[model samples]
Target: MPMEDAGAAKVGPDDLQAMRPHSKPNMPSPFGRLLDRATYWDLMIVASATLLVSSTYFWLAPQSQGALFEGRALTFPEAVYLSIVTFTSLGYGDVLPVGFGRVVAVLDVACGLLLTAVLIGKVASERQASLLLLLHTSDTQRRISAFAKELANIRGALSEKSESEATTKSNRAELYSLRTLTQSISNYMSFNGFQAGIVEFGNFSALSALYDELDLAFEVCSRIVHGSGKNSDAVVMARAVSCCTRIYVLVRLMSRLHRSAATRSSLFGTVLISLRLKKPASLTLAEAAAKNKSELLFQSMAIGLGKAEAWKARGYHSLQLERVLAEMPSGSKDGWGNQVHKLIAAKLGISNSVASKCVATLVELGRLPK
Candidate 1:
């Protein structure tokens, strides 16, 4: 088999592994790690403060002067118990402070109220963190499952062609299904949660698997694009376009993940969700059936890839570039190539080399005036 043929090879679940290395669960010092966590630190701080207050009260007032319970002087144990109850606002009222001890008891109660608030806030924050992690993980799992099904269907569609109308309809249906899955991924990944979650928890495996599937999809599309005949061309083009859409969405997602990871998974990025500028098309396959292979390919490059500015700069097919140039007003033809190149570079976040390639393709296509 040729390189492209090899590239188009189907990957089963057994063939894909999550990209990141498996971290051995540290068996030692579980408690130590817990203590190192922020939640643990918060609890310890409040507990130490309570202990300090209890020790101070125990020393300052004798049993008779400091506290009385059922006409008995408070024991050391009883003083500690009072501190716990006061700090928690549990006020059993079984023990009462007397004399100078009353002043210390009142202060302890005030401190307790503040500490209680802090503890509550800290616990809530910890729970929120956990919930965010869960959401990200669940979303990742969902994407992985969806990708598996999509890739399997695409593989089946491209493996053999059928002359029967039923087969053509089925291929078209599969193409649309893949497009739907790709759009879902686009929407999910546009949110910061996906990137942040993967970075923090090292879910690189899922990400790696995603990239593998995307690469395979591209291969499948490539095979179809080169081998498609007039009868199957439309269906093949639709599938190819769906592959491009998936690649584009996945690439953007990977870019965001890298950015988030580079920042060391900051709490701000991980905890706070960012808003998207606009809603993306809910259905990407709406035009798949209408476009021929060449037209579909250009459309995929122009819109399916991403923001025009971004993908144009990264580079699009010369054919797509030709279409773009041909559509420009005749009056704007002079020095238009440089302007388009610069526009692509500036808007698409691509390098000058890529922008130049896009312009070169247009020139090669003779879309530029002599």
Candidate 2:
């Protein structure tokens, strides 16, 4: 369907089918959530400790019959107390284990030492993870600051009239650098560490500002790339647009996770504003549906490829530079092998750059069958 037909659309079976909302998943119980939060290794350590104590108690109960301070068999409770004390290396003189019981106590103590060592290692690992995460957060902040400065320079250069070919070439080169920076930041921000940081530290206000700056940088870069006929490949433009769009989508997703309604709404508004800033050259069914940030533009972009398994496996939450792989399907008759990307951009209300990226991603993921 053409862009006009998609916009002035009619209700059809496909439209009705796509409109059907999915059922929400059942929420986990409080206890279940606690268990889910616990590492399996920690649970195993507790379980093993319990089993070892129980086994040691059973072993000592029968052997310490009439030989200890009590002139009868050591009861299960006494055996249990002994097991615990021995395991902890708390050699209290209350219960004297003679012969085989001494061996049992030694075994328990040794096991206790091993368990203690394991626990210490686990604690060290957790501390190391925390330290590394702190370092990553600091580095991300520095990068954001650097990118903001670079954007400032680019904006200054863009405002000036090109006096010569050299100046024009210089500005274009700077614009290209700006594009690369946007891509680098996009890649950096997509990591799990950044997502975890958003939850651990309630600094959405700062992050929201960063996202806004990024949006500005990307917009300026997009204008430069599209307006300058120096780059004929539309994919370059698509990549910039995709990066900007992905940033908004990821922030929106993160806002949901961090429960920052204000940040989420702000990003949502930014996305809407972004769409209106540059009226796309083409439209499709998918793009037409995306009137607001509440609509999943990037999410729908991933879905439009019809490669859910590949998308999930790669843990891909953002669109990247998949639009303009010159090496991608140049030999194909359909020109890039399929028009799926076109549909994707149209449906998501994004530019050709984003659509190209969607296609490129599918091609790279091996989702498009041979």
Candidate 3:
């Protein structure tokens, strides 16, 4: 018994070896590999199978001298070509199959056509996926570029505010324009009409003016986060404005829900909520259908008052404002400032000398110093 046990327990190295060297290391089988490799060749495989089935039918069919001579009696070359053509259902009909032979040929062609279509559809679907991926990649690059520009603009605005230079009249106008650009958000929200009953935006009421300004400022930043409007130079600020509108609409619509006694999210100071969050649309840019799970997508944006501090506080600085002033009409790098002055004079119905003095007065103020 001991001798028998020892012989049975002996380990054989040969027994552990695989029949083929390419056998898998960890996986149980080649199923996944087959699927991947087969996906691309699906159409070709169908075409080949279609040809095979059609040719096989012709070859095995009751081959007698008369049957062989009839229905454009085919050899290997002709039969293979006919099989392929029939399978694809693109028969030129130069060689026709008649009677019972025609029936078999037609059946072969139909099956081949159906399988070919399925394979072609799959290929089309894959191509669409690839195109979508490319578009998503392009959008991501744009977002990165926009983010960098915003950071630079914010820095410039802050630097101007931190300066020790005297404020000039030109500087005031430049500041006003920058504020106007930032405050354009009210228009986006006006379209939504969330605040129609409670307030009218623009320079309407004394208290309303304050509310209007807030709405505009909030909208501009929101659009920036969401990437609104056309991707044009003049309309670059549209996205930021849209984001602002979305929030105003949300607050007006959800004010009661947020104010509910049991609600967890704070409703107070919710003016900046949309601004504080990233937009849903920007996230959905690549997706026709959402890849993520969420009830409201834009809430992901972080457009809060704190976020505003990063950009808004810089605008309040003096030296930075001076730089911006220098870059404005009189201080513009482009010669267009003079043309703009000429146009302004024309618009105001003023004389050439008056326009010159106005320009000089702006220069005297630190606004034109940039």
**Which parts of model 3 are misplaced by more than 4 Å?**
1-38, 63-72, 98-100, 131-370
lDDT of 2: 0.46
Tens digits of per-residue lDDT for model 3, 32-86: 3333234445546556766786777665555532124344467766777667777
For this target, which candidate reaches the highest lDDT against the unseen true structure? 1
Off by over 4 Å in 2: 1-74, 91-143, 155-171, 183-199, 220-370
218-280, model 2: which lDDT tens digit per residue?
455445333423222233333333333443444344434333222222222435445775332
Taking all chains together, each candidate's TM-score versus the true structure is 0.39, 0.39, 0.24
Candidate 2 clashing pairs, residues 3+ apart or interchain: 238-353, 286-347, 286-348, 287-346, 287-347, 287-348, 287-349, 323-356, 323-357
Comparing 1 with 2 on lDDT, the higher-scoring candidate is 1
Looking at model 1, residue 293 earns an lDDT score of 29
TM-score of 2: 0.39
Q: In model 3, which range of ten residues has the least summed lDDT?
A: 195-204
Which lDDT value does model 3 have at 317? 23
Report the lDDT of model 2 for residue 240: 33
Candidate 3, lDDT over the whole model: 0.40
Q: Which window of 10 residues has the lowest lDDT sum in candidate 1?
A: 282-291
